[model samples]
Target chain A: MSQPGQGLSVGLFATCINDVMFPDTPKHVAELLTRLGCSLTSSPAQTCCGQMFTNTGYFREGEATVEAYVEAFADCDYVVAPSASCIGSVRHQHQMLAAHRPALARKVDRLIKRSLDLTEFLTDILEVEDVGASFPHTVTYHTGCHSLRVARIGDRPQRLLRAVRGLRLVDLADSDICCGFGGTFCLKNPDVSIAMATNKAKAVADTKAEYLAAVDNACLMNIGGILHRIKAPVTPIHVASILVQQEP
Target chain B: MSQLTTLPRDTDGRLTPAPPPGELIDMPRFPINARHELANTDQRNNLQAATATIRAKRALRVSEVPQWEDLRQAAKTIKDQVDRHLDSYLLQAEQSLTKAGAIVHWARDATEANQIVVDLVKATGAPEVVKVKSMVTQETELNEALEQAGIAAWETDLAELIVQLGHDRPSHVLVPAIHKNRSQIKDIFLTEMGQYGTPAPADLTDDPSALTSAARTHLRNKFMRSTVGISGGNFLVADTGTLVVVESEGNGRMCLTLPQTLISVVGIEKIVPRFEDLEVFMRLLPRSSTGERMNPYTSMWTGVTPGDGPQNVHVVLVDNGRTSVLADPIGRQTLRCIRCSACMNTCPVYTLVGGHAYGSVYPGPIGICLSPLMRGLDSPIDQSLPYACTLCGACPDVCPVKIDFPEVIIHLRHEVAEHKIRDTKPHLETTAIAAAGWFFAKGRRFTVMTWLSGLVGRVFKAKKQFGAHMPWPARLWTSARDLPIPAAESFREWWRRNHERP
Candidate 1:
């Protein structure tokens, strides 16, 4: 597929967790966008879209956060997020939040219409087949719950990864299953949450992948934590991070 | 009643413990070998193929009905209303059933419920009982109880018979032997069926028909001989005092009709306010559960027919923690389940490992929510269930009632935590949470912590462990996952260092 060079200007919304917990994710996303020949800009005003609070039942804080996110991503060609959960919040909840706040609702709807998961934006919108990067390591992909079920993104991540020059993609068993990291769920129900992650870890290990890649970093963190604990060699890398890799 | 002669109620009554409140919480420790079994490629392949086949069939039958969604909404509404007024509905159901000449028994727990049924059976002097597939009976371990009293409980359903003979736990709710493939089933039939079953073909292959026919022949004698039938109701209509049982196979139909005496142990939550309510559930159930537009057998009986089938019908209204589940406002919706395995089948996790990994008879999205409510969140397995999901919305998407399973799971996770705090000492968890709270309380504090993390990330970067650092309980995650080591500077730090005005 030919990469669309025009109409490809993209804006990236690095989730707060990724910003604080793993800043490299957004950095890689920006790098990938640059390589795709899209004029990319990171909106600094975007601290959070209030997903964490809203999911935890703090609607009021979520509303305020949604307003902040809309203001920041207002004029973007397309607002892209690395985390499906964050994008889902903006698409589903922001619309709900906009119901009572009409002014904000109209603004969010405009942005959300053009908003997309990075994989969806890259492969579907930009039509970028391969980013021309090579990492010969065997890797498995996990479809984060939000990306696959919530965002309805299928085969996009794989399509993009398959185009990469040297990546050998081995399918993870139950790749669609959650990594048991529901944000706060990891901290709140640590043991049970870990138990679920262990299963994901085992699945990734079974694939014998050097890297476990997914769209969402929240799931990656939880699975990564479990892998670290068990000392498994599998590395949990965000899809954007992998896509932006250079020939080092 | 010719069927009455075969039931030996006295002996069955003596052996088993009755259904008890929190029976699941105190369940004997199940072996923790689910990981190894789940890794079995053969079982995984079999389960994937089987669940997918049933799901496709269910989807086909259900789509034929244009009003399926409307029926589902109606069912959800009725259930919501019943749950809101459960106490009054239970009393009304009891009064109506009793007035209609059907004896009503109230069971406080599993033991009491089991004893009540056993007492009624003992009163009838039946030595053996033909059983219908009832999740409640399975939940209460009723067959095991009956066996202790030397009253043989014969499983008549195709899947239940396999489970009983195999001496295995029911993995999936609807398809109890879902984890067992045809080869394993053929072997079970071959070995267990001695003279009781038709002689096995010496070289029976893994064809479904061969296995099914072997099972049919094995169960045929039990069906012909047993007089008393013990069953569970899918729905009990309060307005008409009718009990409904929907199944794919014709076994439930035979059990309901051929018996002289019938005892149904039903959860009080199963009550629907009016007979018309059955209209919604009948359509919602078969489609959402078995994915059938309509289940093959849907048997409804009101009280007793003096000369039709069972001369006597007794309905045991079982509480068994249901009242407690109802008492919990958020958790009550779990009782709205119609025992449809749709959610289980569509569930990615449940589909991957099958139901046995949940360590409860009720597995998948519903089980994760229901088990904790019925059993409490004390056991490791029970506590682990809610976290089993990746919070995928697949189960809720296919739910006939739109139970919002993901919402319920997050809620249950909260309950598990609260239970841990109030009931058990959460020393490590509490300490960790407190420590995390202290660190992230303010912007400056968070910034400092992030700064320290960035430094550590650099150390790991030098070692190429980027995206792979974890430090004990947290480290448990890394054994299977790689943590990213942070770059030397964060965006804010980088901005501060590079873009600082000189």
Candidate 2:
């Protein structure tokens, strides 16, 4: 739990979901870190964290992905990922998933100590708020359940958002509840999943904010999909995109 | 009676019950039941309002106590001690109860327990028996057994009376009729109370007070006339042979005291090692259950006195499925539940779907763990109960004994997966997961797979996003919510294109 010195070295651990679907999120995260004066390195050996398999009760299958993740980031000072859910798995679940492999488990423990969710890297490691970016829009932030409860990243994302030049942050009702994008849960139980997502969508719409942003794109995907289906005016944006966007 | 004539006796000359028809797992699967329960708008509204109110009240009351965490830890430690040495505690409890003049009966399962109760009622020659709110009796379906034996069992608690009269199953553990609003209760009382004993007044209204008054009047006659009573114990003190019942309504007090012959059917997990152990539970139960500093009625009794309440007392210690639950190293923590229902109040799923969807006498998070263990997870419904939760962790946060609900749920999911693996044919989910695991094990394979999937996604893109309807296995994701179209270039591809130079 040691603090990183100024100008700390960081590895951009763009998760599989972000790598395949939302490439702009990682791009924005890289720009945000560069703006905050941290050196960024990209590892070509990185892939999925096996959160999907681990969460769906496939521990053995998930262990392989944990081994890949530990190997990918073994030498980095800080491994920063845009998704709290993936970082949560790396920080909390990697040891449990890798327990059968003692040597790999030790590697996982060391990797998790250096792993940080993007917000944690910004707030805790860099000690930087007010990233000197401007975005003129009223936005509501959805705190992913893993980030809020597991990582205990309370108000760090909001504090960073408030410091943006023209970004207005509105409160979301029941902000702490899960938005129902629980890895494979959305597929396993679609009926309940949509029911929960619809409630979250309505809460977001009620805020009348032009944009809904969150640390984890997986939740945003679920909420954003429903918003698009209902033809809501609000768009889903990654918090990193807002932090790095500069007015032309 | 005609029904009793059909009863068979065992070879040892005891009543060999007919397999205790309609035992646990009679209800439909959890998902099917939840689908139906979710469609009922009235039930959803009632549950939402009730759970929200109770949750807020509980939070306020629990926060007032500075040592709440210490109390919860103490409660957990004591329960673990009791569970660890449960064999010795049971023997000590039996010895102490026998010394106090209370007859103790040991029942292996539902049939034996029902037979013991029926024989006890027949010995007293009472045509009817009054009941305090007892979860063990509900778990064993004792009331139906008694009815078949020509004995009418009257439910005295207001909520249980509603469920009994309405011919409905109990939903929530603490509040059996939590799904019913005041007007529904009024209608149930008006139509059903008369057949049971006394009729509801002609001018009865839907007001809660008026409804409770009507229940009180109807139950008074049954309480005065019945010569036998049955109950479930909250906590059984091993050293003192004392049985405690914590309740809100005065009906429990009446049922516990008025009958001449009293029978208590309690789960073996309800025992604590010492009398002082009651202090932690007494404080935890009321606050976690009714959100009250102290419930209106907490009646504790030890055996019988010559001229005092219930001269002939019997204690039936039932281990219907508790021993099996205790055997699981990871799941044994579920037995620590005191049936407070705090987890139910805070659960978003329970608030939305109500308790009947769980298909067990115990509902909510505890039910999800307890029912499967008790029933052996052989049925589809038993397997489905563990997945009913979203793994929100709200239940574990508020649980008095701090049951790690999400951990147990994941463990059960693993059990289900392992069970499926044992079958000749592998499940589609298992196959898909294994395939994904293979790809994820190596970074190069994953990168190649993502590149190909993104290429296909780009070709199939209609109107710049995937349509609402998708093909077969992926349809599970698309049937409800639209999937975001994959990026034309993955982050890895973009990184390779921009940064990598030959």
Candidate 3:
């Protein structure tokens, strides 16, 4: 049987955070999807999803960015992103931005249906659990709030990690709680954000896993900062980077 | 120069002074209050243990019922119906209550509600009252209002008793003293209980049974002696003109029955059109709240009994900012809340900083929506309240009535932004967001910004030295945690060299 991704063109929505801060995550996402037999496409025209603006309550500005996103991937077969949060905003908030106009709402609805978070596309549309990759390390997954609750992506990332040739997936304590990146919330309420991140980092350290893998790089960045700050033995790694590993 | 000279007491020997008048809101901005809360390590430890245990209990109980989701849907539907036809239902309720030989009063705001209750208690010629745990009363500052009129209101519920005795604000809806551990409660009781009413044993320990025994002894006298009882209803059954008060303790039953004159101050939004609608809430509230199959005491009375219970029954339908919440299309669903702290127990933010951080009686996710909607976004705290959550989407998932917390929170945020924009001067946060939105509107501008960051990255790498803190805003991030240096190679730069747009 042919792979589910064999004849599809996938638009890689390298979210702004990944584009500027952690390029490896989206680059790896592109790499993984291409190797899985999907044709990767992109528009350098794409930037932020305006989640920061939308989440911060600046709806008019967020709508401006939302229009740009629509124009960027308007022709793609499917819009997939390494960041679950931006995908969540696209699916959840884009309609509200377009709600004043019925024609635009219908167009945005079409885009929402075609969009998928990385783990979702892998298990849902592509139907492949094991991607024949190997990563010989004990890793735990931090379920990003957007990944777990917003997108409701469930255990697809964990399933993908479990299927890896040499990966041992450990359980994270209170893994469902937010890592506290929260877009602008990290800065707006740094005290609470750092407190939560510290707790999450401590939990990650207690697992004794070599790596903490999460779907969102923003979460990894926040937790990674705390992990690095506290000098914890564990490293924060994205699921894309781990899955893209060809050698243990 | 005696401490006793400073303290005032009512004729019945209950504490006469009322607590702060503000309800359902904290005073300062969220960051400031959250920092204060986060510093108290003991409170943090207590919160973590308490919320975790409650979350586990709720999850286990919720798992037992396969129809839990169905129950949530039914509850949501029933609440939605009440919100849509609230005026008609309120009228129907008044008719039913009057037919059942109960007096009905309407309160347009918290002050009006407080005045009605005070006047009603004064009419009974009562010096004090035993109160069933009521959040609406807290919202109206009713106890304080009563105290202002020289009438003492004695809290009958265990947690409420703890709060009242200690002169502490309620931190959680279900468990008012949720921020306090057993040891803390022991200290509060040892120090404050004797001053208020009955005294604790000299050798009172932090053991649960010991504490309960002490509280029972302290409150039993007040419960029996008080001629008036005050309560806030959980559900106001419109068709039968019934009011419900659910609690784990039997104090609600005692207070609802022992007093001759009973007064219930209910939010207009608490109405459920039919008596049978309670079957849905009875199932959802207990499991979601105390994590029990059913509460130990569920005191529900339709108007009154001829001679049994309190023959003089009064219901004050208070609309303190509730109409404001009802008017919003996006946020009206928040009124569906059943005051079950399921959202609180499961909320990660609430778990960390506890309810005190929210600075409101109704904390966690529900307050984030309801407080802003009811109070408006004009206040600094209310503006900051919407951003308090990490938007983790946990609260909505666990809400018994399926209130979409994140959606409402985001909507409130938009209102806050709009409110800020209406000010004469521009705001830094909104300006920054607008500028970022401008850059993101075009990939070229985004690329240029990334290139600037990459240039800074090169300079830092070349210098082999940079300050630990980047600058003003980034320093906020670096204060507690290390942040990544911007990548020298922008993704666009790498992608351009490697392949075409494809």
Candidate 4:
């Protein structure tokens, strides 16, 4: 397999949640991409892809966020995000935002095509699954609802995890069910949200893995919140954090 | 007649509680109702088990069909075509039904539909009527209407029977009593059966067949004695004037056949282009709904059949807010629903709280999409229905009719937000959301916002609120789970420090 000889121009979209809250997750992605021989750049003009506003019914606000995002990432070769849900919103809702505005619609079309989830970027765009990483722990993967259904990026993260030198990949039971971190849904319907997260949390514990790996940070925040609240031993880790590891 | 069975009359004038006034528009919000139902641990556990069983079975049954996607597309196309020319198809159905000795009545809404059925039953002079499990009739609250007219409507389907006897609203479409376990059902039967009809033996066990037998004994006389029967049509084949009802129990078949007079309350959207349309739906419905290869009993009746079945046949075609839904291109697709309950079975939200939380005749994804469209989002519950989802895409994947649930949900949310048509006026959250939009429109604004959040995180950390619980608004999220600590140095700051050249 011939790697891109010089380097690829890759833009990092540290999704809003990850940028402000869990900086380590996107930092791991930046480190991994840098190791894989990519010229990484972050646009200071970018905050989020407007997923929060989009999903929560604030379309006017969401559209503005999306327009700012396009302005930031329009020139990049491929824009990669560590979160599937943010990327999903960019891909789906951005189009919806531009449905009435033809000028923004064209730019959105171009930006959305190159926008990819970190896993999709690794496995499909770069054609690299094993990122030559190492993690000696039993990790169960939870496919977030957007990653599994909306983005439809299958087994890409798992394949990368499997290649990690000392990692033991265990399958989580009913891994496709949402972890109830449905952004607004968590706060809006906490009772139902808690029940759903409890169900996912049980499935996470059943694997008895040391860590739960998922593509989206929001889902981790939810399921991980439950595990933490219960004083469960499992630590929730992003797929990027696992893939960015080395023996030392 | 096979034999003269002793009809168990309500010797006392006392009747069970009437069904609610109507089922289209309901009262409580999703979160409020969800909170109440979530407290019912027993119901939650029961719903989980029942829905899990159906989900597994449905997946297996669907996998058996090699061209299941093709069947789904075919069904969508057929239904879409009907929606395109609904007026013509409905007229053709009415004409065909009339020609075939069936009196067809058009009802503008629930009141009119209920009145029509009450009058039809009154003309028959039957004190009691047997009923098939029908969602449309459930939506109209036909039983309550009949009760008001001094007619006792005995639900013959086992699940509907349980719901009726328990004096509870249905939580599921196919399995209305799914929230109750066999033991709970046994208790309901034992305590309430005597008040309605045949009393259960003092020693009725929780065994499935045993409970079933008790229900059977209770309903046998109703089927034998009732001269009037009412049903909700699953699909009204317009070209043939045929009404198709596919069911698991023989009760629906009995109700369709045994009575001297049969009145079926069908929604206008139930019309199909042709009789052959059943070929697609028949293959899809049972497999999608009950996960059966074929439903145990399928009853098809065109019209009056001399001395064989009901000599007096009446079909009430209802148009209560359906045309308005049809007018909406996005919402028009909702009328394509066959009520398979696949979306509900697959919905994670529905899995936790069951159908009662939705508070409508339709529940789960269907309820979310259809209820608001049929019954405007004027009420809190109807408005809340659209927001009661995770946008997980599970419903659309499982929906036999391919109703884009997330699309409809998002569209509905847009309606609520843009129009300011919410029950709770002047939302406090609206100010925050609008502020967020302004803050998020530019990257510099977001940087400042994150910086502010980090400052708050430091303040909260000093107060020990970060890992434990957050401030007032965040407290909603932090109550059940730990609050995520905002980063001291965000990724952008890190980039500016290292990667971004000064």
* Per-model TM against the reference: 0.76, 0.94, 0.96, 0.96
lDDT per residue (tens digit) for residues A1-248 in model 3: 24568989988999898888888888998889988889988788888778888888888888877777888888888999987888988998999987887877787888889999898899989998888789999999998999888788888899999999889999999888888889889999999899889889999999999999988889988998888877889988989998888863
At residue B244, candidate 2 shows an lDDT of 92
- How many steric overlaps does candidate 3 have? 1
Clashing pairs in 3: B26-B359
Candidate 3 per-residue lDDT over residues B125-197, each given as its tens digit: 7878889999988888888788778777888889888887766788888888888889989998998787777
- Tens digits of per-residue lDDT for model 2, A1-248: 12234467888999998988899999998877876777777777788777787667788888888878877888889999998878877877788888888999889888899998888888887787877779999999998887876666778889989999988899999886677777777776666777789889999999999999999999999998888888899999999999888878
DockQ per model, Cα: 0.21, 0.63, 0.79, 0.81
Off by over 4 Å in 1: A1-13, A20-24, A28-81, A87-143, A148-214, A218-248, B1-33, B39-42, B59-67, B194-207, B423-426, B466-475, B498-502
Task: Report the Cα lDDT for residue B299, model 1.
Answer: 92
Candidate 2 structure, TM-score to reference: 0.94
TM-score (chain B) for model 1? Answer: 0.89
DockQ of 2: 0.63
lDDT per residue for candidate 2 within B49-164, as digits (tens), equals 88888888898999999999999999999999999999999999999999999999999999999999999998988877889999999889898788788777878889998988
Error of 1 at B2 (Å): 8.5
| Candidate achieving higher lDDT, 2 or 3 | 3
* Model 4 CAPRI rating: high
For residue A72, model 1's alpha carbon misses the true position, in angstroms, by: 11
> Considering every candidate listed, which one attains the maximal DockQ?
4
Give a tens-digit lDDT track for model 4, residues B242-334: 999989989999999889999999999998888888999999999999999999999999998777999999999998889989988788999
